[model samples]
Target: MKCVKTQDAVGHVLCHDITQIIKDVKKGTAFRKGHIVTEEDIPVLLSLGKDNLYIWEKTEGILHENEAAEYLRDICMNENMIQSEVKEGKIELIAEIDGLLKIDVDKLRAVNSLGEMMIATRHTNTTVKKGDKLVGTRIIPLLIEQEKMEKAKEVAGDRPILSLIPFKKKKVGIVTTGNEVFYGRIKDTFGPVVAEKVKEFGADVIGQTIVNDDIEKITKAVEEFIEQGADMVLCTGGMSVDPDDKTPGAIKNTGARIVSYGAPVLPGAMMLLAYYEKDGRELPIVGLPGCVMYAKRTVFDLVLPRLMADDMVTSDDLAGLGLGGLCLSCDICTFPNCGFGKGV
Candidate 1:
C-alpha cells in the first residue's frame, strides 16, 4: 500500500496491490455467480483494467471475461438458448429464428459447448453440396488474461450457413396497366412499389411497359418483355373480372401455364400467377390486383422472400401466408417484426 498526501485532512492514502481486485472481476466470485454487485465494485474493478466486464447489476449477476465467453459459446451450441448477444453481463437474444434467412438457422445451434484453443465446424447442415463451406472461425487478442478469452476463441468458428453459391438473379418484367393512369388521369404508384420490392432481392426490372386495357396489346407487351430476357413478369392492375380487366387474359393468351388463378390472400386475393416454358426455359408471371396498391402487407409480403431466393412458390407457399396474411390496418405499423416481413 502507498500513502496519498493529496487530501488536506488526510495525512496519507494507502496504496495496495490491485491484482486480487482484477482476479475477483475475472471470476464471478467477485459478486455471486448470479448475484448482482453494487457501485462499490466499479472503482475497484477499474483499479485493474476490467473494462470488458459484463455487469447485470440488477440481477446480481456479473459475468467477467471467461464466463461471458462461455455463455456466448453456449448460445451458439444450444438451440433452446435462442440467438442472443451478451451485453452488460446479461444475455439478450431472439427467442426464435423463424425464416431469418434462406438457410435453416437452427443448424447453427447444434455444436457441443467446448472452449478450444483452435477451431472446428460442428454443423454443416449435413446437405452441403460440392461447393458448400459451412464455418469459418478465427482468434483475436482481447488483451485480458490468456485464460479469460479462451471461450471467445471457441465461438470464433463460424455459424455460417452452407457456402455461398452464386446463381443468376431472377430477371423480372413489370407491366403497368390501367387506362386512367396511362393517360395521366392519376399518378402511377404500383410501378414504384413493385420496382422497390424486386430490387431488394437483387432482381432487376429489365423492361417496363405501360399499356391500355386491350388484351392483345398487353399480350404483345408480355412477349416483348420475354424477348428482352425476363424470367418473371409482374403485371399490376386489371386482375378482377371487370370487362376492362385484361391483364389475366393477356397473360393467358401468352400460352403460360396458370399456376393458381386465385389465392386466399385478401386485398391481393385477385392476384394471378402463370408460367411459360419453351425448350426447358421457364418464365413465371404474377398478376397483382389493384388492392396491392395501398394495402401495406398482404400475400405479396409472404411470397416476395421465396421469390427473391429463387425458390419456386408452390400453392403450398401461398397456403402458409393465408393465416398470417390478414392485414390489420395498424395505427403505427411496425412491419417486418409485425408478422409481415414486408419491411424487407
Candidate 2:
C-alpha cells in the first residue's frame, strides 16, 4: 500500500476502511476498502481527520489486512459456526446453533502469540445461543507478511482451533432423598428445581423417586433410574457430611466411578459427581447439594451444559474451578454470564 495526500487521493482505491466516529451518534465504516476515491470523498475524509490515505497497491508475498483476517478465520472456524463478511479487515465467527463452545486454548494462545494478528473469542466451554458472536479475527496492521500467516497456520496444526458441540436431548431421572420429604412432612421442592434446570438443556425428567435417608433405598433408587433407561441421574439433597446424609454413600454403592466427591466452589462444595457404567455405556450420576434447590446458580449450573453435551468432567476439571468458583449471590443474578463457576 502507498500513502498519498487525501486531497490528491481522487481515483485511488482505498487500501483499508475509513472509520467515522461521531461520539454517541455513530461509529462505523464510512468508506470500505477497494473503494475508488472520488473527488467528492475528499471533504468527507478530511472531516474525519484523514490527511493521508493508504492506496491499494498489490505486491508479491504481502497480504492485505482482509486477506490476513480470512486466514486467521480459517484457523478458528469449525462445525456449527459461520463467519461474517470481512468488514474493516476483521472477520467474526457466529454460532450456527445453540451448543457448547469449545476453544483449543493452547493453539489459540499460540496463534495470538504470533504478533500482527489475533483471534479474540468468548470463553471456552461455555454455552452459546444460535447467532451469538463466537470469535473475531484480524491483523494489527493494514498489511502483513504472507509468511507470518503461514507460520500461524503451522502453529494451529491441521485441526481448527474452535468447535461447537450441540447439546443432546437426554432422558433424566431424579432421586429426591431426605426423611422429611419422603415422609410427606414437606413438599419435595428440590425435584422441581432440578427438573426445571435440566429442562433448560432440553432434557426430560422421566421420573422422580422419593427416598428416605436409608443408604440401601437411596442406592436402589439410583439403580432403578438407570434401569429405566435414564441417560443421567440426579440425586438431590442429603449431600452434607452429617450422619444422616446418605446420598454420597448411596452413589458409591451403585458402583459408579466417583469423579469427585467435592468441588472447589461455593454453594456447592458438598456436591458429588460420579458415572455409573452399564453394558458399555457410562451414565452420569450426580449428587447435588441443597444449595442447588435455592441458589440461583451453583456448580450444577456450570457442569450441566457439559453433561448434556456428553462431555465428561474429570477431577482436574473440578479442581480448576477454584479460580472463579465463588458466587456473590447478587440481588439480581446474571449467572453463566457472570464469573460464578467460570474458572478455567
Error of 2 at 207 (Å): 0.4
- After superposition, candidate 2 runs with Cα above 4 Å error: 3-13, 16-54
Error of 2 at 167 (Å): 0.6
**What lDDT does each candidate get?**
0.57, 0.91
Q: Among these predicted structures, which one has the highest lDDT? A: 2
lDDT of 1 by residue, 195-250 (tens): 88777666888878898888998999888888888878899988899898999999
lDDT minimum window of 10 residues, candidate 2: 335-344
lDDT of 2: 0.91
Model 1, position 57, has a per-residue lDDT of 23
Give the CA lDDT, 0 to 100, for residue 294 in model 2: 89
